[model samples]
Target: MAAYEIKFRDARELAEALKALGADMRSLPFFDNRREIRSVYITDVDVRAANVIKQEMLSRGGDAAVHAHAVDCGVTESDVILFGTVKQISFLADKLETMPWWGFPDTVKVLREALASFSKKPATIDLPSGSSLAFGGRTLLMSIINLSDDSFHSESRTYGNVDVAVARAVEHAKDGADILDLGAESTRPGAARISESEEIGRIMPVIREIRKILPLMPISVDTTREKVAKTALEAGADIINDISGLTFEPGIARAVADHNAMLVIMHMRGTPETMGSMCIYSNLLKEINDFFDEKIRTAISSGVDRAKIILDPGVGFAKDYSQNLFLLRHLESFRIHSKPILIGASRKGSVGKATDSPDTAGRLEGTLAVSALCAWAGVDIIRVHDTKENKKAVMMAEAIRNADYA
Candidate 1:
């Protein structure tokens, strides 16, 4: 099965004409966005029929283009087509040479078609605030401000007095943080637990102060305790970043649901203290996928709106070095849930192992590298300790990724 992307001014009209010419109408739709318009996904049979249609469109004063390629068997069985208003079209066909003959044509066709479609309509993603999260758009940087002193990275610790914590939040906000993630308990491996009272006391004052300084900026409280979450929400936090997927604290889901707050559900193997030891997995990707599937269902059951939930693979939380890298490389897989994916690999232990940097402060370059990779993978949010560095990396990545579109 081969696919092709056809670009034209009147995508819907062209799509209708293609369907009239025996193309699959149901399979092709005009991809629309703020920038341009396009239609995509034409099969091999449709591409063959599209040649005549292309000529007819050109003769009728409608500008159109066709990109056709064969599918590859190794990576994908069927060909793909992307029809849009794209300026330049290219693909990694050489990488697909090892694919089976049955797959190569369709795979090639899909790329060509998608590239053609890109000319019609560039892809765009909308954020919760109705802002575009597309490539080249304004990148929102979420700074990691952990109130726990025992967090894995010593630099992430902000266990000072409320004044100090508030100062840190102000500094991050001043340094270009679009969102602040305030966490009370240390989610670091084998960290000592804090009482709910301690957690509330440690976080609430800081949250309240930060809100006073930056009321319009979004504030996220990273906790799994119902009481702490509710307290922070009442204190002016805008979102709940639960690493446990709301399983550790059953009432968190209900509280967040009831409050209509944005919720970030991260996938973790177990509690932080037990996570390092629970790194084993039969299929890492599938396990994470299944975990999110169930957690999403649970969130919805608890009265949370489906659109308010964001999925995080919880990189470096429980996985060993290799698994963390694998998750980062295949980060886009989580998009299957159709929700925004947030990645927090800032100054993580995995980077320590990869770059032989024992100190988190020395891992800024590595963290930026991972942030750039996440941006390339279309991750919606990147939680980082160095907001300035992450924001710069995101800007560069977005610029490079959307160079053609711009």
Candidate 2:
């Protein structure tokens, strides 16, 4: 089943979108008939286009409801809510393109693109090094390689110890891990930030070792700084797992763009030092969605290829324990962006709280619990320290959700 919805570049908030995954194996839309048509909300519509759109939709067996002020000239801006089947919307799309004036052509383009995005979401991503990964088809594990000594998970902290780091990387690979994410600077709350040079120094040897030993493995350099990212990429890292979503450093986007590398953009409210204090939000999910929307625009405008981008909701970066649990439960809502989502809730404080395990290392069960649920929710990537255990959870949940018992 396919859904019908409108997406505008500058429109204000619309109603709650009807989005979720089902066992039917149907694509984006749920259904395409009069009995199951979806609503398209368009905010910030100008008077000229609003009137034209209202009349046009009405003639095509659908109708647009507009604010009353649009007719009386009381309000300069009009918000129009259109309801129709996919076929009827297609008719309006065609009719709008042929119109000579009053912003119909632009509206036509927006409508067409929105409809396409809403209908089909490509799950495979092409990497920069001439490879591609298919997501939403199977569960992929991204093992964490925290290179900072002050990392919350003591077991994962290598503290720039190359020998220890290499061993962990090798262990993760042997544990059926699909990917390795090497992070030099710890983003744990109140953890000290390292300089760019120091960060590069800490992770370079580990990245080099991984590339030399496991040349086929995909390595992601998890840093927000462009200098470290570029250096790491030069050292054979294929992806930039930016915690700041390219916000901390303005140059990070173009660096990834220039390298033509893969990008994993995670969302966080503030810096690690400040995030704990600023964790409050009126609506956590909606704000995260808005953050993704803004970052996507910024990335594209800064020359990033959309296909190479992935999303992570930043589970414990700024969120409290309850909020983190809420995000994992409704993880499906983040799918609206049509990008692969990475859940890095491995041994975070939230997991510790959930399982009543005060120590981060003992939260393996709690971590696997989130991983299994995310796999069931169709999340593409699960970053965890316990690769083997998380893999089991993912496979078991996937077996039930996808009916792949074997």
Model 2 lDDT, residue 151, Cα? 85
Runs off by more than 4 Å, candidate 2: 1-123, 128-131, 404-406
lDDT of 2 by residue, 4-73 (tens): 7544211011112222223342422333333335466655677878988988888887889988877776
**Clash total of candidate 1:** 36
Model 2 clashing residue pairs (backbone): 1-29, 1-30, 2-29, 2-30, 3-29
C-alpha displacement of 105 in model 1, angstroms?
28
> For model 1, where is the 10-residue window of minimal lDDT?
70-79
Measured against the true structure, the TM-scores of the candidates, in listed sequence, are: 0.69, 0.75
